[model samples]
Target chain A: MSVSTSQALDYLEQLPVQTHRKLYEQPSTVLAIFRCMLPHLAKSIVMGMLYMPTPISSPDLDAWFRPSAAKLKRSSLEILEKLHIVSQKQLDAVKHTAFTLSPGFAKSLRQALEGSGTHRSFGVPAPPTSARKVSVAELDDYARIQWESILFYMVGSTVGFHGGGGMARDIGKGTRSLLEAGDFVGKKFGGGVGITRTGFMFVLQDTNAQVWSLLIEYLKHVNQLGMSETDVLSFLFMLGSLELGQDYSTSTLSPTQLQMLIDLTAFGLVYRTSENASTFYPTRLATTLTSDSGALSATNNPHDHAPAPSGGATQKGFIIVETNYRIYAYTSSLLQIAVLSLFCKLTTRFPNLVSGKLTRASISRAVQTGISADQILSYLDSHAHPQMQKSVPFLPPTVTDQIRLWELEGERLECTDGYMLREFPSDKDYRDMVKYAEDLGVLVWKDDGERKFFVNRIEQMQEALKKQGQRRAR
Target chain B: MVKAVRGTLVKCDASIKAMLVDIDSKNNNDFIIEELDEEHMLVKETKVNALKNRLQQMMKDRLKDPTIDEDSGKE
Candidate 1:
């Protein structure tokens, strides 16, 4: 799973079981979850079990995987168990274990794969009517304009790019308040909004990730809006499954989903002729929700004229960074230029190209603004010129290393939110607990002499302690 | 041993090609997994053999009569 999908999965796993059961009732939702949310190995495991008549025995499943891959298998199974997608059973007096897909998940997934269900959850295509049909190209243009307006709204005040006018002002009130609530932007002293650190991180992300980030934030506020979270989520998943450019009827949507459609339209996930339109066309942003980020750039809307430095219909990279730290980007979008200027000492801008240099001052300023060096590096890497892509470590190793060093110069201390454990009854117990925490990958720091350790999470450690207690009792 | 290795490689290549074809049929043509070269052939051969064995086991299980005791053991 990519970072965004894992975040969504983490949120999904936290929901009550009833919500999950309800979500699994929709084949489209199940398919979208299967396609994007599960780890690659977990997907394989699920697919293997999907058509099997009986539960897969633990030993058999273990034997299918290389011994070296056991750790991956364990973690994948752990996530599956947590999501209630799979259940384990002890099959014999000797405690032979078996695993099976949860019935709801298996049935819904089968229905999705077969495309046999009467469930119109995937979406119902709008009937041809007097409503003027919107072209895919127009929808793409609409989505990009609406999306960029929101981004420009966040960035314009901070970068003093407000003179462009009207574009940023067009961002809807609901969207602006949502951005404020999420702390992506804050109201400034005298007047307008200022972009926050989170906003900087958000703007630097690829469009698909940015959209998911915003939607996930919107998901957090669903309850406050007096809507059922599951219904909204299922509708979002359904939008992901919809074929882009096809108009889907609004007739079938519940009141919550209808309200969501209005908000989604503002975010450019869906396009409608007007608020009262009976049908809406999902933009590329909506349809590609469940795909990996790599797949996103390939299917970027043909009419998405965002002057991103890479990968629209042209299939060419636009950003080139030299070993000497000079940078050039072939883009005309004010939004992209503003994003680049956030981390570069840009000196000149031409009709189609912008030139900049990555100086220590610029990088440090960006770091201080809460944009990490790694995020900057990745943004550069993802947008590196095709010529750069031919080489290993796309960005020059010197430039990448120097940027990290600059970030490190900003601070000498690192902080972690966690708990410290000390005062062990025995040295042996402390060693055991430390080793267990290390295995769990939660141990942040430990000292043998002091018999003290720190862990970022305690739930798994508590379980380990309970098992240790049981062993001691035995 | 050489023949077994060769056989496994051939089978692995065929299965992988089949899977790629399946993916392509689904319109996910962007992903193109290249065939294994001589350098990695031996490693890939073993991996494929393991997968083939698991697949055969799955097929065998599918052909067998359903076991009623399987449900009785569920927690």
Candidate 2:
């Protein structure tokens, strides 16, 4: 899944069953969730069960996959269960348990796929208007400008770049507070709101994911703003199904979604002439929200995971690095320059060029702000100049190696995502389990005194504990 | 009766752990769920970002930079 899909999926998976049940009422929302928010395996499982008359038997479902695919099947069902799309049942007539699709979700998805619904959930388009018209190209440009302005505002907030004042300063106060609420930018040490680590990662994500990220944050505030969360969500899903260049009628939207139009306009998801416009157009950003990685590769927006585009042309990447660690970027975009200055000690700037060096202090400073060495290296790799691409690794090996070494200088801690096991029944059990965990190569930290341990992987340890229980019973 | 708590295990130098403990104390002990050993901690997954920001701020104030900007070539 693309970052955008995962962002939406993560948000969807956390919603309570009641919310999901309400959200699944809209055929468009159901379709959008089915298309983008589910794992491929989950999608197949959902489709497989959609039309089945009876609850699928556990053994029958298990028979569908090979033993090698057990892990994937397990995770797919886990997602299905989490979304409340599928639930287990004890059949009165049968000897074993079975699972069936949630009736509402199955019905809505069927209606969405078969075009059998009069729900009017997809969206009602305004009749073509020659009086006030916007073309596709115009919409794309508006999105690029509006989206880049928000990005520039973020970049400008960090590092005190005050002179790039045209569009960046025009970001709405509502959007600014949303950024603040998301912890993208918090009050700095001096006075003004500064970019935090979450903000940096948000800036670094691809454009589609950035939109989802911001929108997910927007969803959190929908409740506080007295807007119905289901209405806001279904409207967003409806926007993804909208046809670009076709104007959508504001009369058909609920009051909450109508309010959303003004905000979505600010985020470049929709284009509107004024706040009171009768019609709004979904930009490229909005129309691509439901695509599965197609949006990521379709536009090749220069502000993506690589360097920001400047004076757009055949020059996709412009940053060139030397073995001596000097860096030269042929771009005039101030946003790109600001991003570079985060990690490089820039020395000179010409009309269309900038020169900088990756110094230890500069790299460490960047790392200090929570940008990882891998993020830096991949950014360099993606932005490697055309001539530099002829080489195997693209980036100068020595420079890349030294950059990693510099990052490790300030790092005295490492983290493992796992669990802390404690409350053992006896000291003997603790010693045995810790020994088993150590032998499994999953032991991260252990304390014999407290009869507790930390393990990076817990599945095997859980199995061992179960075996120990059985042994005690024996 | 073995019990396991789901969290992220953080292993660091004793000095860094001290700083982390200081950060946790200042935040009403919101970041860390438990301190398991001298250098091991189980931290809340969601509060990791807040902890990181605090640590970065702490480090920036403590560490002195040796490199000075010599950008005399700018026009």
**By TM-score, who's the top model here?**
2
lDDT of 1 by residue, A130-157 (tens): 8677876677667767788888888877
> How far in Å is the alpha carbon of A170 misplaced in model 2?
0.8
DockQ (Cα-based) for each candidate: 0.01, 0.64
TM-score of each: 0.78, 0.81
Q: Model 1: clashing residue pairs?
A: none
Q: Model 2 in CAPRI terms: which quality?
A: medium
Interface RMSD of each: 25.5, 1.1
- Write model 2 residue lDDT over A2-83, tens digit each, in one string: 7778888889888999998999999999999899888899999999999999899998999989987776787788788889
Model 1's chain B TM-score? 0.28
Across residues B7-69, which tens digit of lDDT does each residue of candidate 1 receive?
A: 121213454445433443454433322223321111232344344444444445655533334
DockQ of 1: 0.01
> Lowest lDDT 10-mer window, candidate 1 chain A?
A306-315
